[model samples]
Target: MAGKSGRTIANVPEKSLKKTLFCWEGMLVVLFILINVFCASISQSYQFENVLREMPKYLTEMFLLFPMAFILVLGEIDISVGATVCLSATMTCMASNKGLPFAAVILTALLVGTICGLVNGLILTNFQELPPMIVTLGTQIVFRGIAEIALGSGGSISLTNADGFRMIAGKVGIIPYVFFIVILMAVLFSVVLAKTTFGRSVYAIGSNRLAAYYSGIHVQTIRLIIYTVMGFMAGLAALFLTSVLYGANTTTGNGFEMDAIAMAVFGGISTSGGKGRLLGGIISGFTIICLRIGLGQINMNPQLILIILGILLILAVLLPNLSARLNVKKKA
Candidate 1:
């Protein structure tokens, strides 16, 4: 009787989880509509069809940071992303502004970004009590503070002053330089998350760390890797943001982590982690940019958008679990 009771109890959570996943998947439907409306409302210059007129920087947001979404879906947060991004961008900017070649600056950005990610992974995996969100949040402040100290004040450095860097960031016919790289990233990670054993391990970790461990997954090690990947993405994001701004500031990426998290959650990646798709996240991120742009055109405050985002995230978390209960009831 005890064994039977245990099995039944375990099944309850599984049913609940499935229902929750269903709700998350359903969110994509809403995302599709929002994207269309936003595009239609915009002038033709910004429309998808006028691809040549506007450079799509938002693609960078999805490409570089989608891995972070994958990590979050597996139940982790790297709030220090804001800090890490700023640091990497600052590194890249400072290098070029000081007379280094553009290639060297780009290389330095990518390498430093990877190392930053490695650091996040190390800290999270090694220190059992250091919750990622809180630790990263603290680190975010520290990293940015360091940036302020380094720069010493508010000043912008123009990358156009460095012709090579500007050209690289500029354009190639209809494609922006960053857009091509982002496309490659999109294809690459889509495969990594969807078709690999590592992907399964991530889901296992997010869905049930205890089960994943018992099932022979190295939960601690994998968790670190996820955090590490997020760090690297943060770095990649920094590269473009700083270069585009032609300036580095301690506040270069303020609240960017919030936007990314909002995009991830709205796309069906649970705040609690586990069961998310890269394509969904991509759609969701684009959706968010559209939403914000649409709102701005209509003279809406950015803060209002954030409030709406918060409400959506809450609904996202609750609605699916509610459906699961309903599903279980019908079965019973």
Candidate 2:
């Protein structure tokens, strides 16, 4: 091909042939469009307004997905994030009930969540022997237990002054305010992971922690930072979640960590870590949300919906391994 200023034209590079192939991200784009079509077909109520109305509930989980990707890329899991959300929401509600300013309530949520994350980080970094899954499981129980205690016998609390929350839950036109925030954070996180050296180090750590440390990647430091960021995101999630519900309960964030993990895995992020893009995870998160909304509108069984998600998760993990093995067999 020749350009306007062509000195000499070179043939199109052979490398361009490989670039034309569909990668996992490309597959996701196709899947996303198909899912939307499926959803729109299944239920007449699956229109834009209905979807937007149902989306705020799901968007809270998207906040967690961004940080969870970093943690997964570091070859670690934090099951405690759901419980952190519960505790943060509980604290935020309590603060608001006590006549504290709305700003203080928000700060309370962030501080409590960050502290929970920091505790997890400190334990993991300091002990170096405990597995992340086990450590986070322990914290998960403790955090949710704290929320239960805070709620006392009732086990739930409603907002007396919902004025502040109502402001946040407000929509511009038909779109909720939280949607914009989710998009903004998604763009920011995706850029950091794909285009930054720190992101490369996360992949290195996931590939091999010892090798990363030896290469002076500050493995523990990065782990700490990621964990702390996870907590902060959980706090933000709780804030928006409270706005949606106008209160908090012991179960305020139950199963959120799993939901985020499922979205990440379904989007092609390896639970084993070191491979995946945040962009895929973001698209997958919304895909799942829309699917659930469409299903709910049609009066589908909730349990059946869960079963479908579980199947999707298994296929997401298993198909890649099976495909790789088949490729190996062919090469052999």
Candidate 3:
């Protein structure tokens, strides 16, 4: 029988000795229900479109999460993603503000992000010494610091391409470009993760780096590709953020790294790496946005919303670990 998302309970085969159980998804479902009910009971302003309005932002989160999830499954982490967003958006603003053509500015923004990622990939692959977490951490500071200097106390950038950019933030027949991007990215990521040789290499690396290297997987090169993708996705996110805000500034994607990482982790990417799913990430995005909205509906403090998210995050990580240990004990 197929697992969660695209599945039916009646399709289960009786002869099967076991079924793949996703306790994590079950938790996600419960969380979703609780949030919904919580909002229904207390929220006065809840609306159908309000929920729908969040889809694009959800997808925006996915653009970054998918690749990060891929890297996480390969047992790698990039803490600098948030900084990368700040840098990419800032560059977009700087280019446009400096009278550069919109097309030129857009291209520059994407290329800068790609180059930053290329640096990340190169250092991780060649140095054979610099840890991704630490390296990305350094890059994060460098990127954000550049933003602080370049923007010089400016919190937002006015988009000269505001009319063109509105296409992303603007709605079309109840559809958001952001949501379209998320779904497209999801499909692309799913194909890469489940269908490609490179995808298999990613899993192999996550499962065992030494074994992956010995198996002629060109682990280093693949690492470069992954970071590059990660960087590129950040650039795409910058475009959307710039379009929505009609400007780019240092704070445009601030804390985004944490949010993206949280969604990935909530979706089931293990901190130890090599175990997660796309559906998990999607559910995670939905849950976070929904939770925040639900809380706001009830007049809950925004700070409390953050605290609840922290709790959910903790439970999400711990539940699987606890389940695994229980199974081991039972087997023993």
Give all candidate RMSDs, comma-separated: 6.5, 3.3, 5.3
lDDT tens digits, residues 141-252, model 1? Answer: 7777777777776644455455765676777766677777777787787788889998888888889988999999998888777777777777778777664666677677
Q: Judged by lDDT against the true structure, how good is candidate 3?
A: 0.78
Q: How well does model 2 score by local distance difference test?
A: 0.91
Candidate 1 colliding pairs: 73-274, 157-246, 157-247
* Model 2 residue 221 CA deviation in Å: 0.8
Task: Give the lowest summed-lDDT range of ten residues in model 3.
Answer: 13-22
Ranked by TM-score, top first: 2, 3, 1
Cα RMSD (Å) between model 2 and the true structure?
Answer: 3.3
Q: What is the lDDT of every predicted structure here?
A: 0.72, 0.91, 0.78
Give lDDT tens digits, candidate 2, residues 1-332.
66889765778645453454466766777777888899899899889898999899889999999999999888789999999999999999889999999989889989998999999999999999999999999999999998999997448988999899999899999999999999999999999999999999999999999999999999899899999999999999999999998888878898999999999988889878799999889988988898899899999998899999899889889988998999999999
